[model samples]
Target: MEEAAAWLAALDAGSATREEFEAWRAVDSRRAVAFAQVADAFEQIERLRTVHDPLPEPRRLGPVRLNRRNLLRGGVVAGGIAIAGGFAMQAAAREHAETGVGERRTVVLEDGTRVSLNTDTRISWRIKGETRSLWLDQGEIALNVRALAGPPLRLSANGMRFDLEPGAFNARREPETVALLVLKGTASAENRAVRVGALAQAIGRDISVHPAEAVAIDRARSWQNGQLVFEGESLDFVVAEFNRYLDDKLVVADPRLSRIRLGGRFTNTDPTELLKALDASFGIRAKRGESGAIMLSAS
Candidate 1:
């Protein structure tokens, strides 16, 4: 599990090359199993965080590192929340909201800030005098700040705080990564600021900011339309995404099939349709086991 987490973190940090991933996966079948287990565990964290959104007391002055493995074991089942992945932020929150699996909800806070909680998302927020602050515990949220004469809206995620300049933007927090996509106005990730049509990804301790053009912006916000857009994503990555909205998880049984690249758009509501599409296009076969898990293999 540690190795799996290391590989995932390396990939998230953009430090792992394709050859490294391939070589690591080629060593043993158990490595693949470990990777799958770790992936599924994080997916569960994505959903379970909504159900168990607990805020721990503020740590001492130094930076607090949230261990993903410990978070998976302790927080998910025991309702203990850890920020995980060595990101530091203010811990206490004034209010919290969450959405269950396969659910999306729009919430209007006291300050009239409309927050759209995507599937299995949780957030902690506070509206103080002249300052609106929030923390993204897990999943994604689209914040449409009201144009009232109030404080600037601020959000904390993955150990960094963002001051959102009035407008609309989306932020997503995963186990080891945080992404900020500006849709309308401006928002600052750490010290780096982004205006309209910008995408910033914070992985580990590094941040990558890119201009979000029309196509990328549309794809990023496609979840609002009940669709998921992918371009040249791996089979494993695609399956991991499809597992988010699925009750029965999808597993790629053949390790050799993990790296096959796929592209296109698909409905996020139905996993079976995606499986069928994969079968038709990539000649992959899906089988159901008695344990209620769906396994995909080369036909």
Candidate 2:
């Protein structure tokens, strides 16, 4: 590990040639993992530092000057075997993705309608002249769909389909349910599509979803631009979303607190503030672990 970190510092120092680095990689698979691990380690170090800084806005932190001595020491301190490889890189390419902790992007449809990608969201759309299809693999998104001039517009997730006429609002998919929350437009499950909300599984033989004013499957929305919008959601559900944007995830010390109700518009950058806000609103307590990671427990 010490040797690998020294090699990384040499790479960063611009002293090693690409051919040299490639030659080192050719030596063995473990060497490649060790090399990549240095970058991951640096990222993790930076990410963990934010927990202590607790600043709301971004600032300039000077570059790291890793030397042989510090490289050996830090490598020993931050020891981890990197599992990410060529296959992991290829697996990521299977899906179209964009990520932000609490940010959203408006995706315009063919007929000039817009869809918003929720915080930490990823969406894939396949455009076809005859029929348009979109899919949400994970996270939540809002589809302000426009009327299709020629063919019907279709949205699918986990083998479920939704047909939209004109106006629509939020659409989401989870492991269990698919929801279409039409704020302004009309939406219905396609014929032969037996899809509904998560809890409707037992009664889903007909594939019918009852008309709802607004619906959600996994996570909630935010009132502010990048805030989280949770509605009577469990603590664990909210924490999962918060962790989605974080390199360092929140650990619950007690399982009982995870089921507590959590609702708010939380800033994605401010996990500490989010936790404090939740603690103030609900009967929750928090503690910092020895490593400075935040842990929450129900009081």
Candidate 3:
């Protein structure tokens, strides 16, 4: 097991060659099994770290003595293969759903849970007997969870887990944080409860919850209606939000234009109307850049 851990660490660090790994694993059949177990344990530890601790102190592993009894005990030869195969089956059972840029889609899970995906979003879910898990890889989604017997819906995003009651919620994943807005019912993460009109923003293990403002809640609802409702938001903020749904992104070329406040409802798909409004109201020019980005600058 110690050797397996050392090999795994070396592989992870990109210091181990493929030829060297194959030669080492060929020495003993049990060595391969031990290495698989060590790799699995490492993966499980990483997942736990993401959920419980963002930055944990490193700890060195002590010496581990291996024996024939230890190798054979748990039917390691047969059980190791079974465990590896089981993981493959579990992955296959998950149904993946995604949306491209400027696209929106709604999906109904096997358990009747409705999920409305925003642009450029990726998610996978498995709804089977005694298993209800959804993984949000990126982007945003609004979920209307169905009431089902047994355990509540388990949502995993950015390695954080939230057990949600039958309710409506909007979740968005950014580069550094995951934001959850509870529209109805409740959700619990790390033993903290989040009720309706509450917003929970998680940065690793640190999660903070507060009441969502009326505009924020309304914005969440408007996305499903193919619109973006901005109420006196900064030009920079509105541009960033609009870029999410656009392949040809909006860029603020002038720093002076970023702080300008604007408010209105606009279609999520096209930025033409918003650009015209900016030009008409604030003398902001929208020019098509070489890279096809819409550059916003003062006229």
TM-score computed on alpha carbons, candidate 3? 0.73
Judge candidate 1 at residue 118 and give its lDDT.
Answer: 77
Clashing residue pairs in all predictions, respectively, total: 3, 3, 0
> Can you write out model 1's per-residue Cα lDDT over 1-299, one digit (the tens) per residue?
56776785555333465457769988999887766655555544444433344533221112234356645652233222322221112222256677666667777888888998777777867676676777787888888987767546877787556678778988989999998889988887656888888998888768888987665677667877777787888998888877776667888999999989987778876776777788899899999988888999999
Q: Provide C-alpha RMSD values for all models, in order.
A: 12.5, 14.1, 13.7
Better of 1 and 2 by lDDT: 1
Best by lDDT: 3
Residue 231, candidate 3: C-alpha displacement in angstroms: 1.5
Candidate 1: list runs displaced more than 4 Å.
1-93, 213-215
Model 1: lDDT to the true structure? 0.71
lDDT for position 129 in model 2: 62
Candidate 2 per-residue lDDT over residues 124-180, each given as its tens digit = 554646556666766677766676576556666654556666664566666676656
Query: Per-candidate TM vs. native?
Result: 0.68, 0.54, 0.73
The top-ranked prediction according to TM-score is 3
